[model samples]
Target chain A: MWGVATGPLRRRAVAQNLSTTLGCPVLLLLAQGYDRPSYVDVALVLALLGPIGTLVFARLLAEDLDEDPPRAQALTWAAAGFAAAVVLAVCVATEPGRAMVKLLVTGALLIGGNLVASRALARGMPTAEERHG
Target chain B: MDDALIAVALLLVAATATAAVATRDPVHQALVLSLLGVALALLFTVLQAPDVALSQLAVGSALTPLLLLLSVRKVWRRRQRQGRTE
Candidate 1:
């Protein structure tokens, strides 16, 4: 979060995207550790909504970001993998059931949204010549 | 284990909240606030309040940042307009 708050526009977008990708699994682990299935809904919501939030930033700040967009392909993939591993582990622990389905859904959404946000942030910015011309 | 989980979540909440406050730029602040929102939601979940966590996730993750960034954009645009007019 601080990473997002104290950097250039590119870095801030990257940090915001990364946090969304990463926060979902932490929420999942919290749900599993607490033995509260309902709590998983929080993870679900975050997974679904976090990227939308980043997209909000990207769209709202498009002109500012068009100067030098940020990219985090590696970080985004790593975060997605982490989310997959956590969701899988929680699924294994909880066994096959409706809850397991929900966990898988959350993981998918988290990874998908992370990728989308990362791609958006990584879009090429206008070069100086392009901006001036 | 429960105490440990709760402690960790609380610690994260504290750290992220501090980072959010310490940030200077409005854009950066918006980004940090989103992270803070996630941290707070996690804390709520750990403390056995999913309802609170759910609302926190909704408001903190998207709405707050959206409002902040939108307002920032607006202010900048207004300033740009004034500069152009002048």
Candidate 2:
């Protein structure tokens, strides 16, 4: 059997995925008006990956699993909530088409990265016996 | 801009924070943090700043919780083992 892996990388991936999904879009939308390219990149890297960075540190402090999937399910709901919020955003969005496009791309990256990272963490978590024995 | 969805999203903010604080379990608290994360994402939207909202959505709501959960799970297992060993 494969050993359960734990460390900063997976945790980083999780936080990166989470913040990217939830925070990056807002920053991206704001950055769109700016002429400087640096703003956009910084926004993307920081806001998008901030949560992942936080998670990496957090993972080091705690354990990796429990029998409950309620938390996991709640995460899914949060994702849906984010999507619903986006829809609300679009409904209220000002005309010009550019913001919409930016919003869509940002949403895709955040949600996509998040899904991939979560799966990786799930697969990598080690059992208790593996940890102690 | 059905106002209702916006209101719902606004309402979620309190829910998320409450969830985060209401738990004794670190894992559950982490999960609730994600809800707060989504609420933060929604706040970005309402503020007309989708860029911030997008990043928050990607990282805060999704990744943070999972990582925290992963860590919390590990800690939980460790505690359980200690309990068993004792």
Candidate 3:
């Protein structure tokens, strides 16, 4: 299914997925919306954090942006290892049923793949002119 | 696979996402990215997460875009100072 979609479409899907999934946390704020006049303000905080988080990540990975040999390989392997560990741990857990396990695993893979792909694309991006205007 | 709404929701998300990525101007990108956020909020509604939809609408759709536009303008100013078009 993913093979057919263009690159940016895939990336957008990833972004949307991340926002919606991570947004699960926003549910807690719903109960407090009445008492807290600033529930919306809380949501704003998370949204701002997402992009800021991305920028910080970009900064952290700046050294590897120039296509360093060893570091790039290490980063990829590290991401892969993290993904593997999460999925493996979930599979080993006794609580979730098969259906829930499947859903969890798929969600994890989607998020992991998105992060890895976005980082790669960001690194490979040409100058802002080439990327934007 | 269930309702037509889901398909339409997905398409909207796709369009907004495309806009965000395809635009060349950073200001334009910010606008498109904002649209993506709005569309994402709508998607949350389709997914039956009303709380999420509301929060996304408030934050991602509205505030984040404003901030991004402001930041983009600032970046533009800095670029003009540095004599760079991008």
Candidate 4:
């Protein structure tokens, strides 16, 4: 919904990051049914990379994004909240151990990275002239 | 139950692939392609191949779109410069 609803490049990038990092991980974890805890590693990588992906789009498409910077504060927070809820739920399901810690770290990265990425996109990257000067 | 998940993921992949192909603009195609990457990763996960899904997520989710958009930007800049000079 978020990806399709937004027309702006930056907004779509955020949506893509959110879906890939938070949404898919949670769904994949649930589908995995905790059969192999190693699967959580996939989410870990995604949590780490998804926002960086958005940052790439923000930096490269600065001019396009500058004209219509997305102010998606509400949506970003909602996604973060959802990530928190999913993490808490998964932690509850798993035993209190290293795996749980890993999940927590992934959750933190997912939420923190997402917020940072969204803010970066909203602020827009410095133009080449501003950067060089 | 697993079948349901697989079916949903397959449907998503199909839809996004079609959207990516149907889109005319390179920029829009890149966006759809990113989404398509996510969808494919989901399908791979549902099929019980986290390793494959991991690589797909890494390559598809960010790398592919980054490369595509970067090239598009470069091409557009060159075209604009040529247009100005001509």
* Best candidate (score: DockQ): 1
| Residues B1-86, model 3: lDDT tens digits | 33676688799788767766666755445435645665676566556666776666656644565576567657766988889654
Top candidate on lDDT is 1
Candidates ranked by TM-score, best first? 1, 4, 2, 3
Residue A116 displacement (Å), model 2: 2.2
Question: Interface RMSD in Å per candidate, to 1 decimal?
Answer: 1.4, 9.1, 11.1, 2.1
Q: What does candidate 1's lDDT look like per residue over A1-133, in tens digits?
A: 6566566779878887888788788888878777878888889999989999988888887887887878677777888889889988998899788988998898888888888777876774445787885
Per-model TM-score on C-alpha atoms:
0.90, 0.44, 0.37, 0.89
User: Model 1 chain B, poorest ten-residue lDDT window?
Assistant: B20-29
Tens-digit lDDT track of model 4 for A1-133: 3364347666676676566555545653653484778888888877887787777777777888899888878878888888888888788888989998988898888888898888888888776688985
Q: Please report, as a value between 0 and 1, the fraction of native contacts recovered by candidate 3.
A: 0.00
**Candidate 1, after superposition: displacement of residue A8 in Å?**
2.0
Q: List the residue pairs that clash in candidate 1.
A: A5-B28
Higher-TM-score candidate of 1 and 4: 1
- Residue by residue across B32-59, what tens digits does model 2's lDDT show? 4654665676565565565776677567
lDDT of 2 by residue, A8-93 (tens): 33332343345445555544444443333233443445434544544453344333322221124466448646754763464255
TM-score of chain A of 2: 0.45
User: What DockQ does each prediction reach against the true complex?
Assistant: 0.78, 0.07, 0.05, 0.57
Error of 2 at B64 (Å): 8.4
Q: In candidate 2, how many Å is residue A66 off?
A: 8.4
Report the lDDT tens digits of candidate 3 across residue range A1-133: 1211223332432343244324423322331323332233333343444444334323333434345411234444443455455434433443467534443544354345445544543554455677864
Error of 2 at A131 (Å): 16
